[model samples]
Target: MRYACPTPGCPTTAPTRTTRCEQCTRRNSRAHKITLVCGPPCSGKNTWVAKHAQPGDLIVDLDALYTAVNANPTRTDHDQPAALTPFAFDARDAITNRLLHGDHNLRAAWIIHSAPEAATRAEWKQRGANIVMITADQDTLTHRAQVQRPNQWGEHIQDWHRRYTLGHVDRTVTTG
Candidate 1:
């Protein structure tokens, strides 16, 4: 009898005594819907996910993860120390690997990241992820950064703009 693969989004059937199908073992298929939200620091990627994501859906945001792992209680989003960046990224990578190749009960996952390269976007596409690009005018981004983010965020915005390439994203959202 062919049994369904234990991996979350994999569709192949597994043989007897196997925990996952051969394809799944090779990490060939995605087990669920993965939406990759890409944008500058203050572009409302988190807001967009908050508005669209439903209950039980997995939402992975670096800032949120940083806050969760941060030692300080007074630190807010985007104010995390540089020392915590690696930990936050490691956590994100682990969760992303699980989403791509492991078992889970969630139906969908929303990943908030500032992916500014075409290669990164293409990699996500190959892994069966839908990419969404969030953007705002320079003035709007600057203004939002000044009000909502630290002074260094202006540099982040500029860096995103400098590196961002308009790739084959599934959706484009403009937020002021």
Candidate 2:
């Protein structure tokens, strides 16, 4: 019941059912390989995920879902913070629930601002998820965001940038 680490380099041994060594596994099993692509709003998380992930990758897009719910296809009100939290929580729940189903063919990318909550990460890990983290700088994010939604205002972009930069989201990839 032992194996090698899949994270490239680091000659670490892991349990057969786990991707990390015994100690690493104990520490990380509670953490899922949930690739968090965090950056300011408009950071191209969607574009990056679309380009990088394969066909079966489940994309949990809170913005998209919100737009659909509000019937606002253009996302004209994304800057309104008060309007986004419920949508975010719903998206998180949806992603977590899907991951818990234990379907190996389900690869996924979530468009979230920061790393998932510990409980959510653990749920994904127990369901055998591999996490990866992707990020970009403020300038890159601002440009992408602007390009993606030309009609949106600068204040929106600045707000997202500030939040992301302040949060300091670190990325990691874990595979089971």
Candidate 3:
């Protein structure tokens, strides 16, 4: 049974569970098509996934993870403490790494983030991710969030823009 290497640039297949040809395995295995979605608060990253994602497709969304471990599935309260964030990140990474290396059942995974760091985006791109960055002007984003959370949306949007690194996004969609 020959399995094709899922790595981005590798073109070999092998009869092994490592999902890599011998030569490719000498360095590392193939990477999976992990799509990372980024945007400011209320930029509709979740809406995009809800609109397009197929059932059974894995999604790594921080709010969803927070919901999983807490009672309120609608919001992540600010008072929930900083420790939970890192814990959820760990779980997300473990799932992503395992699927990237071993699982053939899933064609791809979606990761939702406000990831403004170039290094983080580059790391995901190198790991075979297609970045979908949804963008909107500060006023637009603030208006979108004002209906729900008015006090903090502007700051979050500013932080995201401040940390955003140009030239990292594979696909950019401007909402406003």
Q: What are the runs in model 2 whose C-alpha is more than 4 Å off?
A: 1-33, 73-88, 97-105, 108-111, 114-140, 143-147, 150-153, 164-176
Model 3 bad stretches (over 4 Å): 1-32, 72-83
lDDT winner between candidates 1 and 2: 1
Worst 10 residues of 3 by lDDT: 72-81
Worst 10 residues of 2 by lDDT: 167-176
The 10-residue segment of model 1 with minimum total lDDT is: 23-32
* Per-residue lDDT over 1-176 for candidate 1, one digit per residue giving the tens place of the 0 to 100 score: 88888756667788864587886665544443788999888888999999999999999999899888888877755887888889999999999988876466677899998999888987887777889998888999899889888789999998988897767888899997
Q: Can you write out model 2's per-residue Cα lDDT over 62-82, one digit (the tens) per residue?
A: 665565567445546453345
TM-score on alpha carbons, each prediction: 0.83, 0.50, 0.73
- How does candidate 3 fare on TM-score? 0.73
User: Candidate 3 residues 39-149, lDDT tens each?
Assistant: 777788888877768888888887777656665556534223355778777777787767556444665578888888888888778766789887787777888767655
Query: By lDDT, who's the top model here?
Result: 1
In angstroms, give how far residue 161 of model 3 lies from its true place: 1.4
Which candidate model has the greater TM-score, 1 or 2? Answer: 1
lDDT score, candidate 3: 0.72
